[model samples]
Target: MPFIDEPAGTTPMTDTAAHGAASPWWQDRTPQEIAALAAADGVALLPLAAIEQHGEHLPLSTDLDIALGLVDAALPRVRAGVPVCVLPPLAVGLSLEHSAFAGTLSLRPETALAVMVELGERVAAAGFRRLVLFNSHGGNKALVDLAALKLRVECRMLVVRANYFRFAPPPDALPADELRHGLHGGALETAMMLHLAPAKVRSGRVGNFDSLGRHLAAAGRLLGPEGEAGFAWMAQDLNPCGATGDARLATPALGDRLVQHFARQLARLVEEAHAFDLARLDGGALDRAD
Candidate 1:
């Protein structure tokens, strides 16, 4: 659901009970074990997120923590039949948009691209055929997408570049207005953080920071910082608090629902990734689908 389009009719499967303790972390596995997983056509999940400002109410590691949490949640659900391993997440990403605020760090665009290319090379060298470039920070979307293409071309690895939220269906409780602001420090993100790491979430500081489009739409110029009309932006351009969206609408209960939703969707993706291949998708498949 998060990438281009989620394949329909994916069976929901999770067998960690039988396959538990198999060590899906690349760091936790020995070279021999890794080789075995690779031989089994394992997916190498590479999570990329940013350490940046998520308003004053949220911690700087909000994006990183949530992305990692999603990986943790999805791993258990991956069926025993599918081999999957995680590369430790890249903590810093392209976050110049949020650099106006303190505690926001970013990798230069070229550095980000180079690092991804190098990591993809290493993953291919490790004998893995599939790589998932899972990105959480919206700021990293462009570069990460480019990196996925690069990995496919250079490393010859089957790659999936996706935003974690793309897996989740829109929440029913969050109003459309609130959802519009969810791109940055809005309700969905705040809700998920509250569910994942509540202690780090500061209360009494939430509010509805208006979307930048609300100010610019009157100009009939669709040059906001998200979706088809999006471009580079400073977070302050949306709100001085350095986070857009309505955090006041976030709740831990909503966060729990969002987390479970994303995890379930991700499990299906890992399964699909295990079976997806470039070779099998030749004229026979493409001609019919296209």
Candidate 2:
């Protein structure tokens, strides 16, 4: 599906439309409305995701789903002092790694790079001084990094890509075995889905990890099976299931904690990054003693 543009009425508010508010941030705000908000605060949140296979139990657009949920969870926190708004998620991304999977949809990395660059320029023009690429899909990392670098140089605005998992490290919550095999549709993701979209999860669907290392070795030639090898050149191959972790151990309780933990951590990161002084520097000895 195509990305949704910010509508007119929505702007930052503690209460969500789901919570009986008329509009949330980015729903439908006039240019003046956005400008006023932007003048007050300089940051915006852009959610990034992929519409690719995520095993039989999860939705094809699981990445987008999770990203949107994270945005919802963060709305109140960011809106207090920031003119934070969520851009419609980019559903297609560089998914060539999972092409072997029947339901996996892939996009050229170049396409994402171009799209993100244009979006960043547009947002900058609209007056946001800082943009956060809140990413939920793994495949879009390189593309996001490239886009952030370009925006930083050209727009002179701080652009950052915050991966949900990496930003919010998993606690020692789940079983060691479950956590050990945890990467894709494993316990963590499944639990999040359970908490966020209980109806979407196929309760009957359950599976354990096959030997992970060997599977990764074979897939490494393509996508490198998660963290099997350092990034090189061509796209690494991946399994057809578009899943890597074991899902059998996933439960709703686990999912809730993980999601809440991640949301809180992400909120903290945004707070810190927003306050960071990107232009600060140590003495390079280029100046003579005054």
TM-score of each: 0.87, 0.79
- Which candidate gets the maximum lDDT versus the true structure? 1
**Candidate 1 lDDT, 1-290, residue by residue in tens:** 11224366664332344467567778986676677778878899998999999998899999998998888888888887887889989999999888888899999999988998899899899898898888888888888889988887777778887788665465576886566555787888899999999998988887787777656754666676665677667888777788887888889998888888888778888888887755753334654432
The 0-to-1 C-alpha lDDT of every candidate, in the order given, reads 0.81, 0.70
Model 1 residue 257 CA deviation in Å: 0.3
What is candidate 2's TM-score against the reference?
0.79
Tally clashing residue pairs in candidate 1.
1
Candidate 1: RMSD to truth: 8.4
Which pairs of residues have clashing backbones in candidate 1?
Answer: 2-166
Per-residue lDDT tens digits for candidate 2, residues 1-290, read: 11135465555442334356424455465566566556755567788888776778888878888888877776656535644656667777787766766677777788789998998898888887778888998778888889999998898888878988676346677775455445667778888899899899887876764434445565544444345454432222223455656788788898888877778766766666666564532324445442
Error of 2 at 248 (Å): 1.3
